[model samples]
Target: MMASAGDMDTGSVLLAEKVTALSDPAAYPEFTAAVTAVETHFSWVFLTDGFAYKLKKPLRTEDMDFTSLAGRTRNCEREVYLNRRLAPDVYLGVVDLMATEDGRLRLFGSGRVVDRLVRMRRLAEDDCLEIRLKRGLVASEDVARLARGLAGFLTSQPPLGPVSPVGLRHEINTSLLDLAVACDGCFEQAVRRVTARLLAFLEYRSDMPGRDRLVDGHGDLRPEHVFLGPPLRIIDCLEFSDALRRRDPVDELAALGMECERLGGAWIGPVLLEAYGKAAGVFPPAGLCAFYRGLRALVRARIAVRHLMEEPIRAPERWPRQAAEYLRLADRAAAELTVPSGRRPSSSAAL
Candidate 1:
């Protein structure tokens, strides 16, 4: 389902509209585009009244690359396909530009192909789980509902194949190596300790039974990507590569737990885990909670480091503080794994 630049229309109609939207309109004189746009930690999303168009920047990271128009188109198509699994009602379709008789860019062609766009039905921003939580609209019942919904989704899908186990490990190792390189001397020891623990855990579990129980999962299941609506809808998957989404179910839960904790809902992790486990008819391996907690922390640390690495020019004034927080989380995760009982107070118990 990967999209390519050739899929869009070469006509100037749609192209003109999109070109005008960018802050630097003059940069693209070929198309008469106009729209208000905003940048995120990852993509440059342009907003129109009725629809939203996402354009992947020419960015590269440890796990992904959107360096070419072709790559971006493919990723955008992947985004539409994968997100539809959870949010079928919201993900409309891919939008493309077509060429007109005079070499003008239009939307989908009555003519020739131009640039590709992922067109989506716009949802109210306030409906996002992150926003709802910030507005004090989220409740414990809502968390429980989300847990049940995700549990149902995970249980219904088949487990990942054996090939995925090796792939997942490689991704974890790669991310850890990147983190180790980016961390300062003060934080390197902590990062190394946690990374080592995770590596050990991966080694021990690689041969464990039930490899098929793992499946392709939402690689970045943060609150921000979840929409709190009639039904919980997860969106914006890691579409650039398969390595990001292919993981253990517990790993997915752990990521969500870490996000909940960071958002001041310390108890939600255990509550959600308990609910999901009950629904799935199994408990995660004993020490895995600890292992994935450490893994999640390290993942977040790596992400923060990647952000700093990718765009040092726009580094937030709080970049140092953010880095420090990630390091602290890594230290805490390492300590948690080494404890006699891996099940310490919930990772988010104090929020």
Candidate 2:
């Protein structure tokens, strides 16, 4: 049975307490040089002077299961293996968090292994493309360079070849329904129209084509994961699901384009697509790319609204607006897909 969208509800784990204790620089000799920790939806990352260590929270969700010690270790192993494709130097490897005889925890030890961490080389925050874009520091040349590099990376990967049609269409269908429910009458008519149209279009073409074109890819391609540097590094791929990671390059590109537009770097999408077009020698149909963009937008919208549903109480201040914005973007995407997509149109705000 398919997992409901509700499965994404964030939950805490008991291991987080242990993970927190490990975050103290005093706990480990190797981290004496630096002391800081960043927490995310499912992990804790301790940053040292030269590197970082990530410990997954013991939680099970629809798409991922990190609840078991062995499961987390496997996830860590896969995380390193898969991420190395995009950021080889940055994703060094996985290490174990072990309890020593003196009753202190240490990484890379032979004591009773209790947990694991994905170790990585750290990059400066200023080099993050998302931050650069927000600060108006990202230039056309920089984006163009990113486009070329990303295109090269995509083209270099071997195709997964024609497999059975995937469950992605069904996943999108559920996402649309979930978004409609989450919107809570926000822009009721437009959201419904978008929901209906998108569902119909997706249902009519339920069988996604070009399975032969699918590649092992970075499933999550948000701007945040992209590092704008002489040495480009894309990290934090969705590491849990094999089905999610096997994707058509165009879909991955479209997801990135959608996020770029969300971040106000609307120009980057077209430029990246153009660059990819040059490198790959062919592109997915413009209508299809538009459809993917729309789907991705709605996906984000559902995720944002989920925060309201899943949180203990008062959700983030921006959750509602963020949800609404993504819904509108989805509406625009559905509309765009209806047009002859030989060329992109300019009146985006009007959408």
Candidate 3:
């Protein structure tokens, strides 16, 4: 006989028990031996036969706090809502991890809610842009599809007003400071040069395209989050902060290009930008695009190095090497940030 919800324990079950239960194939309605668990910095993703369930770790960070059930639940709901903008069919809904009267855990069953999980349709690993790029399977048409899809999504969104260059500088400066400490000042000169160039661009480049055309965009638009399709689907947006999501679309695209280039697809960036320009009807100036790419690269470098600060770091040796690589890329992109001479302005108004 099965336990009833009315007979369940009032106290919330331990997180470990919930994790253990979900890790088992039997916990799901359709059990399979192919169930695999992946642990990210903030959540545990359990991939079953046909679905993926994400359980947020009850942790607090400087930027985000998932310490309370309400907080996690809200974040999960936000994620589903925001990601639907690009990957509508992928974000299914939020579900509960419940505890039954028989001292057993179940998903979506009648019992006391112990935890929340985001249920999503599992996508093919091979279809992800990062995997395809590594395997040399990405083509021009694929990137064009991504560009058009992304441009359509972005253009459909309402503008969230202009982003402040001062705020951006402060954010980048904080990250650079963290990177300097994390790398033992090894990249101090590079950081200084990058920071100076970025500051110069922000201060003097009022004529830069898209200064006033900010929109709520996919904040973390990396290759791993993109799935190549006849209709491309982008997932895992920065749902934690609406303020962060308010960005220039060109800035977001530049970040995507930077990540793609880092993954050995340098040609993808220009193609994406060109296609996006055609679709959006606003070609971002070369100087502005270079500035954005350099800015994103520096920030990415900081993110890569900051991984070393994690307790029991994942792949300790990989972070520094990757950080160095990002720094090199940042330097190369920053080198292209030459303030324009007296040149004729374009007919386009914004990016």
Candidate 4:
């Protein structure tokens, strides 16, 4: 039972309200003094209808953290700068928060330096890709268009010089490790099987070719972060650190594929890969797609676990259920790797 678009939108609005309440004047003065309103979630997002102010929360997670004011501000600035690379029309600039003589909060930088916000042009909620996906409004053509668009972006960008193979290995392993810790006993056997598959993949590919062509990518590439319009827009990149953002493009593609499968659209994996390959002149490495797909599942599992741990009371009891969904996908992906035909294609395979 997947949540409907309407339900998800309602949830987002509720989350917005919760975020506002949590960051209200009485809750945290520094954040309150910096923005007029907060939109809450992952980070405290403040907005004025016309513009958005994103303030990183001083929270830490296995994947990311904005523990200090300076760290938050740095990440905020990075968000604006990096997002502009893909979405120039949106992502205006960083707004600074300034304190008045009377001790009132105000937006600065464009005027005076008081506090900081990652200012961006506000987009309509209805236009969000996540909303569209939930509503069954995202057509195959839309997915094709998005794939072509992303492929073009990757092709035009220069490769991020040789990423350490060890680093890539660590990225996949760390995600599985975190998932194992998070799941504990709920799905011990499933988690263990997935972990073994991940380790095997890493071990088998330790000496694969073309490891130097990896590039900086959207660590969190999903429908929610994409905006569908005349031209599709990918936003909300993992700006907390470059380590996560820099990786094999296949890993990014795998993240999208796993999400699509989870959302009941397994066909999208091959569709997107075919489209991307047409634009980039190459598909993901042989035998690696399944591995990355498993890794993506593991990452989602970690996120589900994090939600359960961080917001036990607020977190849905359905989290373990959702985590199970990802685990199932991981198993499927791992199984695909064992098939003789799975490793046959180098660049002509559909997915």
Q: Which numbered prediction scores highest in lDDT against the true structure?
A: 3
Local error of candidate 3 at residue 59 (angstroms): 1.5
Which scores higher on lDDT, 2 or 3?
Answer: 3
TM-score of 4: 0.77
Clashes per model (N, Cα, C within 3 A): 37, 0, 0, 7
Question: For each candidate, what is the lDDT?
Answer: 0.64, 0.74, 0.80, 0.66
Say what the RMSD of model 4 is: 9.0
**Who is ahead in TM-score, 3 or 4?**
3
Model 4 Cα lDDT, one tens digit per residue, 1-351: 011121131222233333454344443323344435643445667655355667554466555655544655777888888887777888987755544455434453133342356777777667677787677777778878988888877766678776564665565556566666665676667776766656655555554425566777777898778887766778888887787788678778878888877877787788888788877788776477887888788778766765665542344676788788888998888776553334332221111
Give stretches of model 4 more than 4 Å off. Answer: 1-42, 60-67, 108-114, 162-165, 181-184, 205-209, 309-318, 339-351
Maximum-TM-score candidate: 3
Provide the lDDT at 322 for model 1: 65
Q: List model 1 lDDT by residue over 1-351, tens digit each.
A: 111122132232332354553434332223435556777665667666556667655565556656555666788788889889988987777766555676555453376545566777777787787787677787777777888888887777786665343554555566567666664654566666666655555554543325565677788888888887866788887777786677677878877877766676657678878888887787776466666766676667766666565433365555545655755665565565443335333322111
Error of 3 at 36 (Å): 0.6
- Pairs in steric clash, model 3: none
Query: What C-alpha lDDT does candidate 1 achieve relative to the native structure?
Result: 0.64
TM-score of 2: 0.85
